[model samples]
Target: MHVLLTGASGVVGRFVLKRLLDDGCRVTILGRRPVEGFETGFCAYDLADLDPQLPPADALVHCALVHAPGKFRGGEGDDPEQFTRLNVDGTRRLFEAACKAGCRAIVFLSSRAVYGDHRRGETFSEADVPTPDTLYGDVKLAGEQALEGLCGPGLNGIVLRATGVYGVSPGLADHKWSGLFKEFAAGVPIEPRKATEVHGEDLAAAVALVLKKTGVLGAPFQVYNVSDLLLDRQELLALYATEAGLSFDGPAASAATPGEMMTDRLRALGWVPGGRDRLKTFVHSLARRGGAGT
Candidate 1:
Protein backbone atom coordinates (compact mmCIF):
# COMPACT_ATOMS: atom_id res chain seq x y z
CA MET A 1 0.00 0.00 0.00
CA HIS A 2 1.08 3.56 -0.67
CA VAL A 3 0.48 6.22 1.98
CA LEU A 4 1.16 9.94 2.32
CA LEU A 5 1.67 11.16 5.89
CA THR A 6 1.71 14.76 7.04
CA GLY A 7 3.54 15.85 10.20
CA ALA A 8 5.71 12.72 10.06
CA SER A 9 8.12 14.25 12.57
CA GLY A 10 5.52 14.84 15.26
CA VAL A 11 5.09 12.63 18.37
CA VAL A 12 2.15 10.65 17.00
CA GLY A 13 3.15 10.90 13.36
CA ARG A 14 6.58 9.38 14.08
CA PHE A 15 4.99 6.24 15.44
CA VAL A 16 2.50 6.13 12.56
CA LEU A 17 5.36 6.32 10.08
CA LYS A 18 7.23 3.43 11.68
CA ARG A 19 4.14 1.25 11.87
CA LEU A 20 3.29 1.93 8.23
CA LEU A 21 6.82 1.10 7.20
CA ASP A 22 6.78 -2.09 9.23
CA ASP A 23 3.58 -3.07 7.41
CA GLY A 24 5.37 -2.53 4.05
CA CYS A 25 3.59 0.64 2.97
CA ARG A 26 5.38 3.28 0.90
CA VAL A 27 5.12 6.64 2.65
CA THR A 28 5.67 10.18 1.46
CA ILE A 29 5.94 12.76 4.20
CA LEU A 30 4.80 16.39 3.85
CA GLY A 31 6.03 19.01 6.29
CA ARG A 32 7.52 22.50 6.59
CA ARG A 33 11.08 21.29 7.07
CA PRO A 34 12.99 18.27 5.78
CA VAL A 35 13.34 15.55 8.44
CA GLU A 36 16.94 14.56 9.20
CA GLY A 37 17.00 10.84 10.09
CA PHE A 38 14.01 9.49 8.18
CA GLU A 39 14.97 7.93 4.84
CA THR A 40 11.44 8.00 3.41
CA GLY A 41 10.42 10.34 0.61
CA PHE A 42 10.32 13.91 1.98
CA CYS A 43 8.44 16.94 0.69
CA ALA A 44 9.46 20.19 2.31
CA TYR A 45 6.39 22.27 1.71
CA ASP A 46 3.74 23.90 3.84
CA LEU A 47 0.38 22.12 4.00
CA ALA A 48 -1.36 25.30 2.84
CA ASP A 49 0.76 25.47 -0.31
CA LEU A 50 1.84 21.94 -1.12
CA ASP A 51 1.07 20.58 -4.64
CA PRO A 52 -0.76 17.31 -4.04
CA GLN A 53 0.00 15.84 -7.46
CA LEU A 54 3.73 15.93 -6.78
CA PRO A 55 3.72 12.52 -5.01
CA PRO A 56 0.52 10.60 -5.19
CA ALA A 57 -0.36 7.83 -2.78
CA ASP A 58 -3.26 5.50 -2.07
CA ALA A 59 -4.13 7.25 1.22
CA LEU A 60 -3.41 10.50 3.03
CA VAL A 61 -3.13 10.92 6.81
CA HIS A 62 -3.68 14.54 7.83
CA CYS A 63 -1.74 14.96 11.08
CA ALA A 64 -0.32 18.47 10.77
CA LEU A 65 -1.39 21.12 13.30
CA VAL A 66 -0.07 24.24 15.06
CA HIS A 67 0.25 23.03 18.64
CA ALA A 68 2.04 24.09 21.83
CA PRO A 69 1.72 22.90 25.41
CA GLY A 70 -0.70 25.63 26.50
CA LYS A 71 -2.90 28.19 24.83
CA PHE A 72 -2.11 29.11 21.22
CA ARG A 73 0.09 32.19 21.59
CA GLY A 74 0.67 33.12 17.94
CA GLY A 75 -2.90 34.21 17.33
CA GLU A 76 -4.62 37.49 18.09
CA GLY A 77 -6.74 37.81 21.22
CA ASP A 78 -9.94 35.80 20.95
CA ASP A 79 -9.98 36.17 17.19
CA PRO A 80 -11.02 32.66 16.19
CA GLU A 81 -10.38 33.63 12.56
CA GLN A 82 -6.70 32.97 13.06
CA PHE A 83 -7.32 29.49 14.42
CA THR A 84 -9.62 28.78 11.48
CA ARG A 85 -6.95 29.96 9.08
CA LEU A 86 -4.45 27.42 10.33
CA ASN A 87 -6.46 24.41 11.43
CA VAL A 88 -9.57 24.62 9.27
CA ASP A 89 -8.17 26.29 6.17
CA GLY A 90 -5.07 24.14 6.20
CA THR A 91 -7.20 20.99 6.54
CA ARG A 92 -9.48 22.09 3.69
CA ARG A 93 -6.49 22.51 1.44
CA LEU A 94 -5.15 19.04 2.27
CA PHE A 95 -8.54 17.43 1.79
CA GLU A 96 -8.91 19.07 -1.59
CA ALA A 97 -5.39 18.11 -2.58
CA ALA A 98 -5.76 14.52 -1.43
CA CYS A 99 -9.08 14.17 -3.26
CA LYS A 100 -7.66 15.62 -6.43
CA ALA A 101 -4.74 13.23 -6.14
CA GLY A 102 -7.19 10.30 -6.21
CA CYS A 103 -6.44 9.07 -2.73
CA ARG A 104 -9.00 6.53 -1.53
CA ALA A 105 -8.70 7.29 2.19
CA ILE A 106 -8.09 10.38 4.29
CA VAL A 107 -7.61 10.11 8.04
CA PHE A 108 -7.79 13.30 10.07
CA LEU A 109 -6.19 13.58 13.49
CA SER A 110 -8.82 15.39 15.54
CA SER A 111 -9.12 15.79 19.30
CA ARG A 112 -11.54 15.31 22.14
CA ALA A 113 -11.25 19.05 22.55
CA VAL A 114 -14.05 19.27 20.02
CA TYR A 115 -16.38 17.88 22.66
CA GLY A 116 -15.29 20.72 24.96
CA ASP A 117 -15.31 20.52 28.77
CA HIS A 118 -18.41 18.58 29.72
CA ARG A 119 -20.13 18.98 33.06
CA ARG A 120 -19.22 16.52 35.78
CA GLY A 121 -20.77 13.10 35.11
CA GLU A 122 -21.33 13.94 31.47
CA THR A 123 -19.73 11.76 28.79
CA PHE A 124 -19.45 12.39 25.07
CA SER A 125 -20.19 9.81 22.45
CA GLU A 126 -19.96 9.79 18.66
CA ALA A 127 -23.71 10.33 18.56
CA ASP A 128 -23.69 13.56 20.55
CA VAL A 129 -23.60 16.96 18.88
CA PRO A 130 -20.24 18.70 19.22
CA THR A 131 -20.16 21.71 21.54
CA PRO A 132 -16.76 23.38 21.39
CA ASP A 133 -15.84 25.47 24.42
CA THR A 134 -12.55 26.94 23.22
CA LEU A 135 -11.04 28.37 20.08
CA TYR A 136 -8.88 25.28 19.70
CA GLY A 137 -11.85 22.95 19.94
CA ASP A 138 -13.93 25.02 17.55
CA VAL A 139 -11.16 25.04 15.00
CA LYS A 140 -10.73 21.26 15.15
CA LEU A 141 -14.45 20.77 14.65
CA ALA A 142 -14.27 23.03 11.63
CA GLY A 143 -11.42 20.98 10.23
CA GLU A 144 -13.47 17.80 10.59
CA GLN A 145 -16.32 19.36 8.70
CA ALA A 146 -14.06 20.45 5.86
CA LEU A 147 -12.57 17.00 5.54
CA GLU A 148 -16.00 15.43 5.43
CA GLY A 149 -17.30 17.72 2.68
CA LEU A 150 -14.33 17.01 0.44
CA CYS A 151 -14.54 13.26 0.93
CA GLY A 152 -17.64 12.23 -0.99
CA PRO A 153 -18.74 8.66 -1.64
CA GLY A 154 -15.56 8.02 -3.58
CA LEU A 155 -13.33 8.19 -0.52
CA ASN A 156 -13.19 6.86 3.03
CA GLY A 157 -12.79 9.62 5.60
CA ILE A 158 -12.11 9.02 9.29
CA VAL A 159 -11.70 11.31 12.26
CA LEU A 160 -9.91 10.12 15.40
CA ARG A 161 -10.94 12.13 18.44
CA ALA A 162 -7.98 11.41 20.69
CA THR A 163 -7.26 12.47 24.24
CA GLY A 164 -3.97 13.17 26.04
CA VAL A 165 -1.14 11.00 24.70
CA TYR A 166 1.84 9.94 26.86
CA GLY A 167 4.88 7.79 26.14
CA VAL A 168 8.69 7.80 26.07
CA SER A 169 10.45 8.94 22.95
CA PRO A 170 13.96 9.64 21.67
CA GLY A 171 15.64 12.70 23.22
CA LEU A 172 13.81 11.87 26.43
CA ALA A 173 15.27 14.84 28.28
CA ASP A 174 13.04 17.42 26.63
CA HIS A 175 9.78 15.47 26.70
CA LYS A 176 6.72 17.26 28.07
CA TRP A 177 6.19 14.68 30.80
CA SER A 178 9.83 14.51 31.88
CA GLY A 179 9.61 16.94 34.80
CA LEU A 180 6.27 15.61 36.03
CA PHE A 181 7.43 12.01 35.88
CA LYS A 182 10.72 12.91 37.58
CA GLU A 183 8.86 14.67 40.39
CA PHE A 184 6.64 11.68 40.90
CA ALA A 185 9.53 9.23 40.77
CA ALA A 186 11.65 11.17 43.27
CA GLY A 187 8.76 11.57 45.71
CA VAL A 188 8.82 15.33 45.25
CA PRO A 189 5.53 16.84 46.29
CA ILE A 190 3.48 17.78 43.24
CA GLU A 191 -0.07 18.17 42.05
CA PRO A 192 -1.24 16.85 38.68
CA ARG A 193 -4.79 16.68 37.36
CA LYS A 194 -6.09 13.16 37.27
CA ALA A 195 -6.84 12.71 33.58
CA THR A 196 -7.04 10.22 30.74
CA GLU A 197 -4.03 9.18 28.67
CA VAL A 198 -3.32 7.03 25.62
CA HIS A 199 -0.03 5.48 24.66
CA GLY A 200 1.52 6.60 21.36
CA GLU A 201 2.08 3.08 20.13
CA ASP A 202 -1.55 2.12 20.67
CA LEU A 203 -2.72 5.26 18.90
CA ALA A 204 -0.52 4.42 15.96
CA ALA A 205 -1.94 0.95 15.87
CA ALA A 206 -5.52 2.26 15.85
CA VAL A 207 -4.79 4.48 12.88
CA ALA A 208 -3.23 1.56 11.07
CA LEU A 209 -6.28 -0.56 11.76
CA VAL A 210 -8.51 2.08 10.24
CA LEU A 211 -6.26 2.32 7.24
CA LYS A 212 -6.09 -1.42 6.63
CA LYS A 213 -9.79 -2.03 7.12
CA THR A 214 -11.43 -2.34 3.71
CA GLY A 215 -14.86 -0.81 3.93
CA VAL A 216 -16.83 2.42 3.93
CA LEU A 217 -16.24 2.54 7.75
CA GLY A 218 -20.08 2.61 8.30
CA ALA A 219 -20.23 6.39 8.15
CA PRO A 220 -19.06 9.14 5.87
CA PHE A 221 -17.39 11.08 8.61
CA GLN A 222 -16.59 8.12 10.81
CA VAL A 223 -15.63 9.36 14.27
CA TYR A 224 -13.98 7.25 16.96
CA ASN A 225 -12.95 8.21 20.51
CA VAL A 226 -9.43 6.92 21.13
CA SER A 227 -8.32 6.54 24.72
CA ASP A 228 -6.58 3.69 26.53
CA LEU A 229 -6.13 4.28 30.25
CA LEU A 230 -8.26 6.07 32.82
CA LEU A 231 -6.53 6.83 36.12
CA ASP A 232 -6.83 9.47 38.79
CA ARG A 233 -3.91 11.83 39.36
CA GLN A 234 -3.13 10.12 42.67
CA GLU A 235 -3.14 6.65 41.20
CA LEU A 236 -0.73 7.63 38.43
CA LEU A 237 1.60 9.33 40.87
CA ALA A 238 1.48 6.37 43.24
CA LEU A 239 2.25 3.98 40.39
CA TYR A 240 5.27 5.98 39.31
CA ALA A 241 6.48 6.31 42.87
CA THR A 242 6.21 2.60 43.44
CA GLU A 243 8.13 1.89 40.25
CA ALA A 244 10.90 4.15 41.57
CA GLY A 245 10.95 2.42 44.99
CA LEU A 246 9.04 5.15 46.80
CA SER A 247 5.72 5.11 48.62
CA PHE A 248 2.95 7.66 48.58
CA ASP A 249 3.90 10.41 51.00
CA GLY A 250 0.35 11.48 51.79
CA PRO A 251 -3.28 11.05 50.81
CA ALA A 252 -3.56 11.92 47.15
CA ALA A 253 -6.07 14.51 46.12
CA SER A 254 -9.45 13.26 44.91
CA ALA A 255 -9.73 12.78 41.19
CA ALA A 256 -11.52 15.59 39.45
CA THR A 257 -14.67 14.68 37.55
CA PRO A 258 -12.64 12.67 35.03
CA GLY A 259 -12.35 14.29 31.62
CA GLU A 260 -12.07 11.67 28.90
CA MET A 261 -14.12 10.01 26.18
CA MET A 262 -14.89 6.33 26.46
CA THR A 263 -13.35 4.13 23.75
CA ASP A 264 -16.15 1.59 23.47
CA ARG A 265 -16.82 2.17 19.75
CA LEU A 266 -13.22 1.63 18.75
CA ARG A 267 -12.91 -1.43 20.96
CA ALA A 268 -16.08 -2.91 19.45
CA LEU A 269 -14.23 -2.86 16.15
CA GLY A 270 -11.56 -5.15 17.70
CA TRP A 271 -9.16 -2.41 18.87
CA VAL A 272 -7.84 -3.44 22.27
CA PRO A 273 -6.12 -0.69 24.26
CA GLY A 274 -3.01 -0.80 26.38
CA GLY A 275 -4.11 -0.07 29.92
CA ARG A 276 -2.18 0.68 33.16
CA ASP A 277 0.66 -1.54 32.05
CA ARG A 278 1.28 0.90 29.21
CA LEU A 279 1.80 3.76 31.64
CA LYS A 280 4.10 1.63 33.80
CA THR A 281 6.08 0.63 30.74
CA PHE A 282 6.39 4.26 29.74
CA VAL A 283 7.87 5.12 33.15
CA HIS A 284 10.22 2.15 33.08
CA SER A 285 11.39 3.18 29.62
CA LEU A 286 11.97 6.68 30.87
CA ALA A 287 13.91 5.40 33.88
CA ARG A 288 16.16 3.35 31.63
CA ARG A 289 16.80 6.47 29.56
CA GLY A 290 18.44 8.43 32.42
CA GLY A 291 15.17 9.90 33.61
CA ALA A 292 15.79 8.56 37.11
CA GLY A 293 18.86 10.80 37.44
CA THR A 294 17.08 13.86 36.15
Candidate 2:
Protein backbone atom coordinates (compact mmCIF):
# COMPACT_ATOMS: atom_id res chain seq x y z
CA MET A 1 0.00 0.00 0.00
CA HIS A 2 1.15 3.49 -0.81
CA VAL A 3 0.58 5.86 2.11
CA LEU A 4 0.91 9.64 2.34
CA LEU A 5 1.74 10.97 5.79
CA THR A 6 1.75 14.58 6.93
CA GLY A 7 3.49 15.93 10.08
CA ALA A 8 6.09 13.17 9.85
CA SER A 9 8.61 15.34 11.73
CA GLY A 10 6.38 15.48 14.77
CA VAL A 11 6.55 12.91 17.59
CA VAL A 12 3.19 11.35 16.80
CA GLY A 13 3.78 11.37 13.04
CA ARG A 14 7.20 9.77 13.54
CA PHE A 15 5.49 6.93 15.36
CA VAL A 16 3.03 6.57 12.50
CA LEU A 17 5.75 6.81 9.85
CA LYS A 18 7.96 4.15 11.46
CA ARG A 19 5.01 1.79 11.95
CA LEU A 20 3.75 2.20 8.36
CA LEU A 21 7.24 1.43 7.01
CA ASP A 22 7.68 -1.53 9.37
CA ASP A 23 4.31 -2.81 8.13
CA GLY A 24 5.74 -2.76 4.56
CA CYS A 25 3.82 0.21 3.17
CA ARG A 26 5.49 2.59 0.77
CA VAL A 27 4.98 5.85 2.70
CA THR A 28 5.57 9.35 1.34
CA ILE A 29 5.85 12.28 3.73
CA LEU A 30 4.19 15.63 2.91
CA GLY A 31 5.26 18.85 4.57
CA ARG A 32 6.90 22.23 3.97
CA ARG A 33 10.26 20.49 4.33
CA PRO A 34 10.85 16.78 3.77
CA VAL A 35 11.74 14.87 6.93
CA GLU A 36 15.27 13.45 6.66
CA GLY A 37 15.77 9.67 6.72
CA PHE A 38 12.03 9.00 6.79
CA GLU A 39 10.65 10.00 3.42
CA THR A 40 10.24 7.33 0.79
CA GLY A 41 8.76 10.19 -1.27
CA PHE A 42 8.29 13.83 -0.30
CA CYS A 43 5.47 16.13 -1.39
CA ALA A 44 6.06 19.74 -0.36
CA TYR A 45 2.59 21.21 -0.56
CA ASP A 46 1.19 24.03 1.54
CA LEU A 47 -1.68 22.94 3.74
CA ALA A 48 -3.39 26.28 3.02
CA ASP A 49 -3.03 25.55 -0.70
CA LEU A 50 -3.60 21.83 -1.24
CA ASP A 51 -3.40 20.47 -4.78
CA PRO A 52 -4.95 17.26 -6.03
CA GLN A 53 -1.94 17.13 -8.38
CA LEU A 54 0.06 15.52 -5.57
CA PRO A 55 0.86 11.85 -5.78
CA PRO A 56 -1.95 9.42 -5.04
CA ALA A 57 -1.80 6.89 -2.23
CA ASP A 58 -4.05 4.15 -0.87
CA ALA A 59 -4.15 5.86 2.55
CA LEU A 60 -3.38 9.39 3.83
CA VAL A 61 -2.83 10.19 7.50
CA HIS A 62 -3.64 13.87 8.14
CA CYS A 63 -1.65 14.66 11.31
CA ALA A 64 -0.46 18.11 10.32
CA LEU A 65 -1.84 21.15 12.15
CA VAL A 66 -0.95 24.84 12.39
CA HIS A 67 -0.31 25.68 16.02
CA ALA A 68 1.97 27.75 18.19
CA PRO A 69 5.24 26.10 19.12
CA GLY A 70 5.21 23.71 22.12
CA LYS A 71 1.46 23.92 22.53
CA PHE A 72 -1.85 22.61 21.20
CA ARG A 73 -4.81 23.59 23.44
CA GLY A 74 -4.10 27.32 23.16
CA GLY A 75 -1.77 27.03 20.19
CA GLU A 76 -3.38 29.90 18.28
CA GLY A 77 -1.26 32.44 20.18
CA ASP A 78 -2.17 35.96 19.00
CA ASP A 79 -3.78 34.85 15.74
CA PRO A 80 -6.92 32.80 16.18
CA GLU A 81 -8.16 33.75 12.71
CA GLN A 82 -5.09 32.37 10.97
CA PHE A 83 -5.25 29.32 13.20
CA THR A 84 -8.75 28.44 11.98
CA ARG A 85 -7.87 29.24 8.39
CA LEU A 86 -4.91 26.87 8.44
CA ASN A 87 -6.04 24.04 10.70
CA VAL A 88 -9.78 23.74 10.07
CA ASP A 89 -10.07 25.19 6.56
CA GLY A 90 -6.82 23.67 5.41
CA THR A 91 -7.86 20.27 6.72
CA ARG A 92 -11.18 20.41 4.88
CA ARG A 93 -9.38 21.26 1.66
CA LEU A 94 -6.91 18.41 2.18
CA PHE A 95 -9.77 16.00 2.73
CA GLU A 96 -11.39 17.05 -0.53
CA ALA A 97 -8.14 16.72 -2.45
CA ALA A 98 -7.52 13.23 -1.07
CA CYS A 99 -11.08 12.22 -1.89
CA LYS A 100 -10.74 13.56 -5.44
CA ALA A 101 -7.41 11.77 -5.78
CA GLY A 102 -9.22 8.51 -4.89
CA CYS A 103 -7.52 7.83 -1.59
CA ARG A 104 -9.47 4.98 -0.06
CA ALA A 105 -8.90 5.88 3.59
CA ILE A 106 -7.89 9.10 5.38
CA VAL A 107 -7.30 9.12 9.11
CA PHE A 108 -7.57 12.51 10.78
CA LEU A 109 -5.79 13.09 14.11
CA SER A 110 -8.33 14.91 16.24
CA SER A 111 -7.99 15.77 19.97
CA ARG A 112 -9.72 14.88 23.22
CA ALA A 113 -10.22 18.60 23.91
CA VAL A 114 -13.26 18.37 21.60
CA TYR A 115 -15.18 17.11 24.61
CA GLY A 116 -15.01 20.39 26.46
CA ASP A 117 -16.63 21.08 29.83
CA HIS A 118 -17.75 17.52 30.28
CA ARG A 119 -18.76 16.45 33.77
CA ARG A 120 -15.74 15.63 35.90
CA GLY A 121 -14.84 11.94 35.65
CA GLU A 122 -17.06 11.38 32.65
CA THR A 123 -15.91 8.60 30.37
CA PHE A 124 -16.11 10.41 27.04
CA SER A 125 -16.79 8.36 23.94
CA GLU A 126 -17.44 8.81 20.21
CA ALA A 127 -21.18 8.99 20.82
CA ASP A 128 -20.85 12.20 22.84
CA VAL A 129 -21.35 15.43 20.92
CA PRO A 130 -18.37 17.75 20.93
CA THR A 131 -18.55 20.96 22.92
CA PRO A 132 -15.22 22.61 22.28
CA ASP A 133 -14.31 25.39 24.69
CA THR A 134 -11.18 26.89 23.21
CA LEU A 135 -10.29 27.75 19.66
CA TYR A 136 -7.99 24.76 19.46
CA GLY A 137 -10.72 22.33 20.40
CA ASP A 138 -13.13 24.08 18.06
CA VAL A 139 -10.63 23.83 15.24
CA LYS A 140 -9.93 20.13 15.82
CA LEU A 141 -13.66 19.37 16.01
CA ALA A 142 -14.17 21.33 12.82
CA GLY A 143 -11.46 19.33 11.11
CA GLU A 144 -13.17 16.11 12.17
CA GLN A 145 -16.46 17.36 10.74
CA ALA A 146 -14.72 18.37 7.54
CA LEU A 147 -13.46 14.82 7.06
CA GLU A 148 -16.88 13.47 7.94
CA GLY A 149 -18.45 15.70 5.31
CA LEU A 150 -16.15 14.21 2.67
CA CYS A 151 -16.72 10.53 3.45
CA GLY A 152 -18.63 8.65 0.77
CA PRO A 153 -18.43 5.96 -1.92
CA GLY A 154 -14.75 6.38 -2.61
CA LEU A 155 -13.65 7.69 0.77
CA ASN A 156 -13.62 6.17 4.23
CA GLY A 157 -12.55 8.68 6.89
CA ILE A 158 -11.46 7.91 10.45
CA VAL A 159 -11.13 10.50 13.19
CA LEU A 160 -9.07 9.45 16.19
CA ARG A 161 -9.80 11.84 19.07
CA ALA A 162 -6.62 11.22 20.96
CA THR A 163 -5.60 12.23 24.46
CA GLY A 164 -2.13 13.14 25.72
CA VAL A 165 0.34 11.19 23.54
CA TYR A 166 3.66 10.10 25.10
CA GLY A 167 6.63 8.47 23.40
CA VAL A 168 10.26 8.86 22.32
CA SER A 169 12.17 8.08 19.13
CA PRO A 170 15.88 7.68 18.47
CA GLY A 171 17.89 10.94 18.14
CA LEU A 172 14.84 12.92 19.32
CA ALA A 173 16.71 13.81 22.56
CA ASP A 174 13.61 14.83 24.56
CA HIS A 175 9.92 13.99 24.92
CA LYS A 176 6.73 15.41 26.47
CA TRP A 177 7.70 14.37 30.02
CA SER A 178 11.39 15.13 29.71
CA GLY A 179 11.14 18.54 31.34
CA LEU A 180 9.00 17.23 34.18
CA PHE A 181 11.50 14.50 34.79
CA LYS A 182 14.29 17.07 34.88
CA GLU A 183 12.48 19.13 37.48
CA PHE A 184 11.93 16.06 39.60
CA ALA A 185 15.57 14.98 39.33
CA ALA A 186 16.82 18.40 40.36
CA GLY A 187 14.85 18.24 43.60
CA VAL A 188 12.28 20.77 42.46
CA PRO A 189 9.01 20.21 44.25
CA ILE A 190 6.76 18.19 41.98
CA GLU A 191 3.02 18.70 41.80
CA PRO A 192 0.25 16.19 41.66
CA ARG A 193 -1.64 15.95 38.36
CA LYS A 194 -3.28 13.23 36.38
CA ALA A 195 -4.50 12.81 32.84
CA THR A 196 -5.26 10.14 30.30
CA GLU A 197 -2.42 9.27 27.96
CA VAL A 198 -1.76 6.88 25.09
CA HIS A 199 1.57 5.83 23.64
CA GLY A 200 2.02 7.16 20.12
CA GLU A 201 2.65 3.61 18.90
CA ASP A 202 -0.81 2.64 20.11
CA LEU A 203 -2.39 5.68 18.48
CA ALA A 204 -0.65 4.81 15.21
CA ALA A 205 -1.92 1.26 15.55
CA ALA A 206 -5.46 2.59 15.82
CA VAL A 207 -4.89 4.57 12.64
CA ALA A 208 -3.54 1.50 10.86
CA LEU A 209 -6.49 -0.62 11.92
CA VAL A 210 -8.97 1.89 10.51
CA LEU A 211 -6.99 2.28 7.31
CA LYS A 212 -6.61 -1.49 6.90
CA LYS A 213 -10.35 -2.12 6.70
CA THR A 214 -11.12 0.79 4.41
CA GLY A 215 -13.36 -0.63 1.72
CA VAL A 216 -15.07 -3.14 4.02
CA LEU A 217 -15.15 -0.83 7.10
CA GLY A 218 -18.98 -0.68 6.74
CA ALA A 219 -19.36 2.92 7.93
CA PRO A 220 -18.03 5.68 5.72
CA PHE A 221 -17.13 7.90 8.67
CA GLN A 222 -15.96 6.56 12.01
CA VAL A 223 -14.77 8.37 15.18
CA TYR A 224 -12.67 6.56 17.75
CA ASN A 225 -11.27 7.84 21.05
CA VAL A 226 -7.62 6.80 21.40
CA SER A 227 -6.11 6.73 24.88
CA ASP A 228 -4.67 4.24 27.37
CA LEU A 229 -3.69 4.92 30.98
CA LEU A 230 -5.20 7.34 33.47
CA LEU A 231 -1.88 8.20 35.09
CA ASP A 232 -1.02 10.43 38.05
CA ARG A 233 2.03 12.64 37.86
CA GLN A 234 3.21 11.78 41.35
CA GLU A 235 3.32 8.10 40.51
CA LEU A 236 4.97 8.71 37.15
CA LEU A 237 7.66 11.05 38.46
CA ALA A 238 8.27 8.83 41.44
CA LEU A 239 9.51 6.12 39.10
CA TYR A 240 12.15 8.48 37.67
CA ALA A 241 13.11 9.76 41.13
CA THR A 242 13.49 6.23 42.42
CA GLU A 243 15.61 5.10 39.48
CA ALA A 244 17.81 8.20 39.60
CA GLY A 245 18.57 7.71 43.32
CA LEU A 246 16.73 10.92 44.17
CA SER A 247 14.83 10.82 47.41
CA PHE A 248 11.44 12.47 46.90
CA ASP A 249 7.80 11.67 47.40
CA GLY A 250 6.49 14.67 45.44
CA PRO A 251 3.09 16.14 46.23
CA ALA A 252 -0.03 14.48 47.58
CA ALA A 253 -2.26 12.77 45.05
CA SER A 254 -4.38 15.23 43.14
CA ALA A 255 -7.92 15.59 44.40
CA ALA A 256 -9.00 16.62 40.95
CA THR A 257 -10.59 13.72 39.12
CA PRO A 258 -9.13 12.96 35.76
CA GLY A 259 -11.48 11.97 32.95
CA GLU A 260 -11.09 8.95 30.74
CA MET A 261 -11.55 8.81 26.96
CA MET A 262 -13.05 5.47 26.01
CA THR A 263 -11.17 3.54 23.33
CA ASP A 264 -13.71 0.73 23.10
CA ARG A 265 -14.64 1.67 19.53
CA LEU A 266 -11.07 1.32 18.40
CA ARG A 267 -10.69 -1.76 20.60
CA ALA A 268 -13.61 -3.33 18.73
CA LEU A 269 -11.41 -3.06 15.64
CA GLY A 270 -8.89 -5.31 17.44
CA TRP A 271 -6.74 -2.37 18.49
CA VAL A 272 -4.75 -3.17 21.65
CA PRO A 273 -2.78 -0.54 23.56
CA GLY A 274 0.37 -0.84 25.65
CA GLY A 275 -1.25 0.00 28.93
CA ARG A 276 0.33 0.48 32.40
CA ASP A 277 3.14 -1.90 31.60
CA ARG A 278 4.07 0.16 28.56
CA LEU A 279 4.03 3.34 30.62
CA LYS A 280 6.48 1.85 33.14
CA THR A 281 8.77 0.60 30.38
CA PHE A 282 8.92 4.07 28.83
CA VAL A 283 9.73 5.79 32.13
CA HIS A 284 12.35 3.21 32.96
CA SER A 285 13.99 3.63 29.55
CA LEU A 286 14.22 7.40 29.98
CA ALA A 287 15.60 7.13 33.49
CA ARG A 288 18.26 4.70 32.28
CA ARG A 289 19.33 7.17 29.62
CA GLY A 290 21.64 9.04 32.05
CA GLY A 291 18.69 11.02 33.45
CA ALA A 292 15.57 11.83 31.38
CA GLY A 293 16.44 15.49 30.80
CA THR A 294 19.69 14.63 29.07
Clashes of each: 1, 0
Off by over 4 Å in 2: 50-52
TM-score of 2: 0.96
lDDT for model 1, on a 0 to 1 scale?
0.74
> Model 2 shows how many backbone clashes?
0
What overall lDDT goes with each candidate model?
A: 0.74, 0.83
Q: What is the C-alpha RMSD of each candidate to the true structure, in Å?
A: 2.7, 1.4
Q: Which ten residues in a row have the lowest lDDT in candidate 2?
A: 45-54
* Per-residue lDDT over 120-234 for candidate 1, one digit per residue giving the tens place of the 0 to 100 score: 4467788888987777788779888988787667788889998877774432335547677666666667765666678877888888989987364676568889987766777
Q: After superposition, how far is residue 283 of candidate 2 from its true place, in Å?
A: 1.1
